[model samples]
Target: MPNLTEPKLISGNANRTLAKAVARRMSMHRGMSVGLVDARVERFNDQEIFVEVFENVRGEDMFIIQPTSNPANDNLMELLIISDALRRSSAARITAVIPYFGYARQDRRTKARTPITAKLVANMIAEAGIERILTMDLHAAQIQGFFDIPVDNLYASPIFSLDIMHNFRSQMDNLMIVSPDVGGVARARELAQRIGAPLAIVDKRREKPGEIAEMTVIGDVTGKTCIIVDDICDTAGTLCKAAEVLIGAGATEVHSYITHGVLSGPAVGRIQNSVMKSLVITDSIEATDAVKATSNIRIVPTAPMFAQAILNIWNGTSVSSLFDHETLTPIYEGMYSAA
Candidate 1:
């Protein structure tokens, strides 16, 4: 068996907060050490990226933490160069731990001339010497099939599930899981099953890209508490529009549990003015100033779960239990009571 202990953690500039938390959690429990290589990512005259690994990483099992979020191309290029450097340094293995895998929304070709960028990203990582991948709640689970190496797709729901249990214990009876789109029905259904609630879907027509949505609800949500779940919340357009439809359908209160908050242009203002009671997102991507300032937005940390998974991987253990839906209940109870 491969030795899993004493793995060294290396990270890029993306989501440094999450990487540090994962590193700190694992090091404390496993007594392993982590070293960060200063890449100092900078742009060249032609807009290309330059990276230099500042530390020696020879003969180490390396995990490079980088989320391919905003400035996606640049951040991705940084990750590739860093991985190639470690590979050249004779690292035993290189694992790319991406809390948020960007380009995932482009997993399939929706129309003629459209490219599947998600597959391309996977190919790029594989070519960059990543022996394995560790990512969370990919926009499409099937995207893992695009990777030739082993991929461990982690879920934020376990983290979110705990939060829901503790924060809404008294209101569980009236809870209904709502999928903002028809495609996300499965994800919402999984969450609904975990929390013991019914599932609802929003039927919306897309008139044009970047335009307002025309929504029709699919389930009876009258006088009930609604929780909208999705993989990513970008621009907050879909979420805000869905909330309006749900409220109109008689939903008393609305909350959201989304994995990656890609809170791009106007997202903060939209959510602040929406009918949502609160919006909870994971720290997969570094929060923008607007995200932090928004009062109704609460952030839940995935550091513990991620830390535990890293430890287990290093120790040569099964990580499937980490995906168990029930594991989040007690963890949330603890956090809820403590908070």
Candidate 2:
């Protein structure tokens, strides 16, 4: 049996705001003292990384919250070094909490000589002595198979669904959920089912990386408010193109709810000039100044969900139950009292 004691939460340089938010939520929801593990992560003159855990973590379950987002290599190295530090400190268990898993899009080979970097990253984490992984919606779910340890892939659908209900309840009758491509139809369908809306798909062809060749609307979107759904909005090319097509096809308004907002390379600029009314994304990746400056971009908090999952894992409960929004009552009702 695993230890039922409260786990030590550690935050990395990547997405510290989110880590702090999760710590706060855990303290409130679990009715116990929860705080970030004191650690000093710094860089040497040659740009090498150094990590030192100030507190004694012997026999303690440690959860390190780090998302490999912008400056991906630095953040990833931070996570690995932190895990190794915790392992050497005699920690009972270490869970790498990577909210936005970078390199996940490279899970497979597109060319004969292309490498599957996702698997390589997974191996690195496992080799670094991480016993488990907790991440949000991965670009490719199969990436979980790349790891030998237990992996819990949480979804942002529940958060998006609740936000939609609160913001668009009055306009539900004219709403439609849209997938930017065929691959994302399943994700779009799930959100559509949750909000009781019709579904649509945008057939898009990519001729090269980060470029959309042609896009076409597959279903009737006439006079409907379209909600475009996708896992990541990297450059905003697909999103802008999809929104343009939906508007051209007679949709009244267009909005988006994406899991990770990897807004890179003129993405904010493109969104500013696009037809999208708003782009709702989770705080999986730390928001940049450009993201904050964009009026149409909104960030939804994901710490509550992550905090609940950490509590469940610590208590040896089912983390998957967090997916069912209807059963989330117990999460707020002191579910960890027995622990």
Candidate 3:
């Protein structure tokens, strides 16, 4: 029950833009004053990472905002090393605010001789002396069990739904929520229910990663504007294919709102050339130059949402406030209505 008044923010090389945005949003808090820690995370010629904190963090609440996104190994190691440094520096509490848990997709072992890397990552973070974990839209919910410490899994539904409501108000009647696969039905249904839109499913099977079997639309999408909801969009193969399938199913328009845009490999090219109308992703991961140049892909900031969550955690407020449609809807709208 450690109180987090005047929390200290820290960042790694991974997604520094997002870390800065979170700090900026937290600065808007009237009750508490927070600032980014002065720390240097550099490397040597042999690619070894080094960390040094310039300020005193003794007995102060610390939150490391690092998303293990691209260059997953390097980012992951950096998070672990930074947390170790903070713990040794005697920070009162260290919470890893990971926007994108890169190893989350491998939460379970699907085949013989395979390892559950997600659980391993969780163990590493805990062993690094991170007292708590704050992440968003985990690929699998049960991954929470892998951690022995307090874990807060924040939902981005409010942000995404409010955005949808603002931008697609005119098409609310004609809009439909679609799950790319059966596993994502719950996430999609939540958004659909929140926005009062009908739900559809793309019954898809993938023989292997990035290779999809035949996909069929479970609900009639003819003449409807379809919106696909999912957690991660890596490489954009499944997303582009799902869009093609929806278009072939007579969908008038197709757009995707994914939480973590792990746009590795040819994701940018695929997204740009795909039949989808638009691909909206959260700024959980830093946008690449290619992603910035793409006209069809847009990024929504998650800093405001994380800033609120971090504040609540410190104030002993229930994190469930983030899911309250009546309360959070207006806040999200005000934050991103113009965008």
Clashing pairs in 3: none
Q: Which is better, 1 or 3, measured by TM-score?
A: 3
RMSD (Cα, Å) for all candidates, in order, is: 2.1, 3.6, 1.9
Q: What global local distance difference test value does model 3 have?
A: 0.89
Residue 92 lDDT, candidate 2, scale 0-100: 95
Candidate 3 Cα deviation (angstroms), residue 229? 0.6
lDDT of 3 at 121: 90
Q: Candidate 1: lDDT of 206?
A: 90
Scanning candidate 2 in windows of ten residues, the lowest lDDT window is: 330-339
Q: What is candidate 1's local distance difference test score? A: 0.85
lDDT, candidate 2, 31-51, per-residue tens: 887889989999999999999
Kindly give the number of clashing pairs for every candidate: 1, 0, 0
Candidate 2 Cα outliers beyond 4 Å, as residue runs: 1-4, 329-339
Per-residue lDDT for 137-170 in model 1, tens only? 9999899999999999998877777778779889
For model 3, what is the error of residue 303's alpha carbon versus the real structure, in angstroms, after optimal superposition?
0.6
> What overall lDDT goes with each candidate model?
0.85, 0.91, 0.89
* lDDT ranking from best candidate downward: 2, 3, 1
Query: Which clashing pairs does model 1 show?
Result: 4-314
